[model samples]
Target chain A: MPEKAQILDQLYELIQPFAKEPIEFGEQTDLIDEVGLDSMKIMDMVMQIEDHFDVSIPLNVLTDVRTIGDMAGQLQGLMKDD
Target chain B: MSELLNKFLPLEAKRSELVAIGGADPFHVVVERVVSATEAIVNGQQVIMAGTNNYLGLTFDPESVEASCAAVRDEGTGTTGSRMANGSYGAHLALERALADFYACPAAIVFSTGYIANLGILSTLTGSGDVILMDADCHASIYDGTRLGAAQVVRFRHNDAANLERRLQRLEDKAKRTLVVVEGIYSMLGDRAPLQEIVEVKNRYGASLLIDEAHSLGVLGDHGRGLAEELGVEDQVDFITGTFSKSLGSIGGYCVSRWAELEFMRYAMRPYIFTASSSPSLIASTRIALKKLNSGTVLRKQLWANAHQLYQGLAEMGLELGPQVSPVIAIRLPVSMEEAPGVWGELLSKGIYVNLVLPPATPDGGCLLRCSLSAAHSPEQIDRILAAFSDIKEKIAPEKSG
Candidate 1:
């Protein structure tokens, strides 16, 4: 798997518990709609992401994230910044 | 801008209407009104108050009133600071000591509100990498606290120990750090948690336990110590968190544990460190209330009697009730949002007040008229409430029958 695909798979694994249905890892998968992530569940996912990647994602970033690709891109950006 | 605000508006507008109707205060003492509490006084009407949470009826007690007055006179209006700053005073320490003795625990930390107690304790104790196994029906405060802690929170079925066991079994070997949370008595459904089974599950999983005794503190146990003591697992549980707002007739919360290190969390918990400490008057009144709780077996008996009377009354009316009888008697209404408003309005017209709960607040897509009984309620008052319900049934019965 490519590096981005590997990262996306890890993110999907972290979000699986909170998702009401199976989540597909790709650029177009809407994080909130497909996974049924409410505000609380979204925060839970963010915390897990922070711990797993060892990076702090500000809560404000959640408002801009709509899809798995958005989240992965944000994570990648945070990793680069670190 | 207005349109943008509309987009964020609640979709359940009809349910809000029903709540508003139920809460409208009648201008007359005899009429049932939700918001106009003083209206009942003006009308000279015999209103049966079922909406209030004054379970022990201590709020009406002369002794409590006097104690509150004295505390206000002695301690002034507020503490005006956080416990981490200027919040802790002599009265706060005294109350903490009293709660420690009452629970027979080595350490007790008080919070400004019952909500904060859960928030402070849960958020501070658990963190990233820790797990929180909670009941699905746990209070919103507990859920928010777990969120604030940023822990991996998993919920089991409401009051189901076996499901909790199954969830715990799936946790990593590092599950020893997991925190299991449960409530002593659920607020919405008026049902008690299976503490014994939950404790057994926790022990088997090697997880720590935190039980929020907000509803059960003065309503359960021999000395009103709460579910932990009532179930004979007081020593087994790691922490007991409760509030003075419910049965104690005051405003504050506390968590007690045998672990001395629990006290250090007080310093780190943001809710405790940021919020202003509870007022001196509240602490004084709560301390007195605790003493009254310890000595007043008669009050508890009377409360139970009233609860049973109301439960049986509602049950005989063929109203759907909770699983087990408690001080809270929730009458499940037919699941029609349109019909609920009419019934709630009729109840208020009959001079009886009750809490109107609609989805998604109620479980299983039902509406609830939650009636809370108090120890101070006279047998006559309970009968009066039943009579109002009967009258309501008569008015609504024809609609259903037709």
Candidate 2:
């Protein structure tokens, strides 16, 4: 798997376009509200991330993910299978 | 606890907010009276309609209207039973034959609605151990059909042939078992699939291809066949599905194919068998509309002309538009979601009735004020629509060029 920091950065970049204001990604940062990502935007971002990382992140995986930290952890689990 | 109700609370809240912002109920903006193919009275105000997908504008055609009325009076209103039982009227078979002749395919099957055509065909054509290679942005019916078929569904990027090839390459026995599906013109974006490119990829991989010409029919090709015919890949496409609702100005769906084996779908397709067949009036009127769609060169030219006119007019207002220009001209909102419906409501109050598409339906998360143009729309009506936009230009639409 790629480095955690690197994955986090990619995740940040994925959502940066949808952000309402200048935002930063940290462990506890809410991916939805803080990043201003709607459910559809998140779905689009997840697909892009899956394409980039060569991993299949299912909808159920995202159901449990709320914060940037949760996303990183989920990505780690999915990429380990690869 | 009622688990279903609990599960739907979030959706309930979202819909409530959407309805609240639109002032009136957004879902049912009832057309109080339809004055013509392009004009309707909504909430007691006469409005120029840009929402109805009457692309060829045959709904109010005197011939179609007369024939349909006659059928309704003579034959009856409905089949009242599923086609599998006693519902296969003579008119249904006739429409199917006409569709097959129009597509120049060996066989065609007509369904009650376009939704059922996808549901029936996609399910019956595949099963367990087969795989469906679908576009990520495919219509919901396509996805549901795959689910019902119990096939492994893998989504490629929308309209990206390379992405499709990549998925097909990864599959074992890559070609023989995989079914790749795309839309001739995607309903949401009004963008077309690179059917020639998709066909090339499918052929190279030996995979079968299905193109849903739901939006492109009567709007794209020289003969109004669809995007596949427009791109000169009609013969190569394994299956072509389309709706009679939009261009035909009637309610029904059809799938045509060169393969004679497709006729066996009458026995195997559940959605087709279990559902009531289309009424005689719909079939009769649809037959009339199909002839016009096939032979009306002037109508096709006028549709494109109107499309380009509205597309350019919206672009001049600095509004974001769907890629290229077709009958469906989708204007996206660059503002917040809250403001999206407000703009839609405002447009309605100004004697304009267009679609207010929100999240999940739109390709991106953005909202859209989608307009479906028709050939019958007069130049004066087009001007009125443009002027309505001019009336509320800066307040709602973003100042983003192109």
Candidate 3:
């Protein structure tokens, strides 16, 4: 798998525990809407992402993080910054 | 499908039966007044407030008010930043120390709100593999905190020690870091938890226990230390979390524990480290309120007297109350969602203000008009409240009788 695809898969796995339905790690899957992530659960997912990636995703990053693709992109950006 | 979302939505097909006047402020109505609030002129009516959580009646107490004013003068309007930056004041440390002494614990940490205190403590303390075995009726805060921790969350029947033990036994032997959570007094039903039985279960399982005393902080125990103290298991319980909003008549929460690791959680806990610390005036006022709460056994006696009076008065009216009565007395109503609004409207129209809880919030398809009595309430106020309930009974009885 490509690095971006790997990152997306990891995000999907982190959210899969809390998600009501099976999550697809592709485009068109909106993390908040399609996956049914409530505000509190989304926060928990964010904390998990931080620990998994070993990167502190700033609170501002959440504003743009609506889907798995967006999250992967943000993670990619953070990895580059490292 | 977003059916789950649709199910939880307050503004769905359920709207036709109940009118949604405004946005989500939980109370579902806007207030249009400011006054001296032993009794408030709410929405153009002089309403006797049996709903307010002003337990000790210290919100308008001369000493409390004066202490708050003095603190505001000494410290500015707001801390203006998180405790990590500019929020931690001398008052905050002093209040933490005072709480530690009050609970007779080694250390205590304060949070911005009661909800966040649970969120911070539970989320920070437990991790991915840990399990949190909680009472099914534990407050939303406790549930949210467990969710945040990503822990294996299992809930037992409310106040049932045997059920709690069964769930603990079901967990894997390696999951030894299990945390058990229970409330001192349930907010909706107004019933106390069986703390002694719960503590016994926790001890048997070798699990850590956290008791939230939000409702019972000043109402239970001789010194008002709370349920565990009342049950004589205070030392056995690992952690005690409570709020100043109820009896202390302020707006903050605290977690007290004998464990030294609790102190380190202040640095690591996101809710504690990220959010702005409590205001200096709130800290100072809470400190003062704690002193009064510890010293004033007379106030507690008056509170119970008022509670008993209201409880008996409501029962005499043939209204269905909960199994037990504490400071909070919930009048059980018919199960229909439609009946709740009418009862709530009638009570409000009769110049008595009480909380209206609907289906899912109340247990087993129950609806309740939850009335919380304060020590500040005079006998006359209590009499008037009973009169309003009596009038409500008269209005609703004929229709049911037919």
Best by lDDT: 2
lDDT of 1: 0.78
List per-prediction Cα lDDT, in the order shown.
0.78, 0.84, 0.80
| Candidate 2 lDDT over residue span B1-402, tens digit each | 687679879877877787787565567678889899999899999999998988888998888988899999988998898888986778888888999999899999999999999999888897777778888889989977876786666778888888778767667483578889999888877888988889998898888999999998998888899998898888899899889899999899999998989998789888988888898899999999998888768888888889889989988888778997888888888877767777888888888899988877888778888999999988888888999888888875665458
Worst 10 residues of 2 chain B by lDDT: B166-175
- The worst-scoring run of ten residues by lDDT in candidate 1 chain B lies at B34-43
Off by over 4 Å in 1: A1-82, B1-46, B394-402
Better of 2 and 3 by TM-score: 2
Docking class of 1: incorrect
TM-score of chain A of each: 0.88, 0.86, 0.87
**What are the candidates' interface root-mean-square deviations?**
9.9, 3.6, 13.8
Q: Is candidate 1 or candidate 2 better by DockQ?
A: 2
TM-score of 1: 0.79
lDDT of each residue in B1-402, candidate 1, tens digit only: 677778545754644565565554322223333232111431345456786777787764567778778888987898778978874788889988998988888999999999999999989898877778887778889978877887767766679898777667656484688899998888887798899988888998899999999988889999988888888899888998888887888899899997878988976899999999988777777877888999968988998998899888877776667888888788877647556756865776776777777666665556787888778788987888899888876533323343
Candidate 2, residue A65: Cα displacement in angstroms equals: 11
Model 1 has a clash total of 16
- Tens digits of per-residue lDDT for model 2, A23-82: 666878997878877776787777787777765564445768999889989899767754
Error of 1 at A82 (Å): 29
